[model samples]
Target: MIELRDAAYDYGGGGLALRGLDLSLAPGSFHFLTGPSGAGKTTLLKLLYGELRPTGGAALLFGSDTRAMDRDGVSDARRRIGVVHQDCRFLDHLPVHDNVALPLRVAGGDVASRADDVAQLLGWVGLGARMHARPPELSGGERQRAALARALVMDPDVLIADEPTGNVDWDMSQRLLTLLAELNRMGKAVIVATHDLALIRAAKAQVAARVLRLSGGALSAAGADL
Candidate 1:
């Protein structure tokens, strides 16, 4: 659904965060993005979701060049891609269910009519009983699952999770990985950006995935050791 051809991004004077990175994400494909801090994993994710267009090469969303897309075009393209940032950014004042539904509301979706769908999504993420709870009340694992639910609310074709298991313990991380694997089984393209080798290894046992490492402004297939 998305393709990056020799994609490159520069933060003005900061130099290129990413360069000559080529990638293609097809339906039901699974990928793991790994690198050290400041390796441009997040920058690559932004490019995939249309948050930042590539300055040097083409980044395409559903066949349209990101650089050529107008505001509305970019916005429309983003609706097909769901992102879970490292920090689960939820409105503390809103109930868990409300936060999950926020994207739909923002997209002008009829929240009232989609109540059942929203509740079902929460249940899918194992948060059915915590729907009424506030964000601050959730445990780290619960918060991550809630974030996943929120990302899936739009039923996007691709799911991009950045360091999804970073804060959770081993067991929780495994749980989250299983959830992601299950989603892939259901035919959603999944790209998880994490530095945890253990997490990636554990995932390999559960799903077939391409491990890509970003370093020195370039991307390459990870070796078997990964």
Candidate 2:
């Protein structure tokens, strides 16, 4: 559902993020993006989610060229994709339920009608009792799940998570991975960008994962070990 052809992103002032990167992700496919710091993993994820347009070449989402898409077009395209960032931020004053439902609210949906649905989603991510709590009150893992719940709240066609397991412990990480695996099984394409090889290994054991490593502003299939 996503493709990048000869994509190059220049950060300006002698820095380039991506260079001639050619990548494609099939619908319902599960993949891991791995690389060292500043290797363009996050840049690549931004490209997929329409947060960044390639400086050269084409970056396509579900057949729509990102460079050619207008603001409304980009927003519409992003509605089909969900992203979990490394540092998930939420309004500290808002309750967890409200924070998770912010996207729907921003999209001008009927909040009352979607209240129960958002609550159930919070419960799914193990935040049922914490629904009334503010974001600052949540623990690290709780915040992570809250972010995941928020991402899935849109029921997106494609899920892109950047360093999802970064803040959680091993067991919690496994639980989050399992949840993502289940989503992939349910036919939602998932792309995760992470530096943890162990997490990738764990995920690969549960699903047929296609792993890619970004290096020197380029992307390629990861070797067997990673």
Best-matching candidate per lDDT: 1
Candidate 1: clashing pairs of residues: none
Model 1 spans > 4 angstroms off:
none
Give the per-residue lDDT of model 1 (tens digit) for 37-115: 8898999999999999998899999999999999999998888888888899999999999999999998999999998
lDDT of 2 by residue, 103-127 (tens): 8887788888999999999888889
> How many residue pairs clash (N, CA or C atoms closer than 3 angstroms) in each of the candidate models, in the order given?
0, 0
In model 2, the worst 10-residue window by lDDT is: 16-25
TM-score of 1: 0.97
TM-score of each: 0.97, 0.96
Candidate lDDT values, in order: 0.93, 0.88
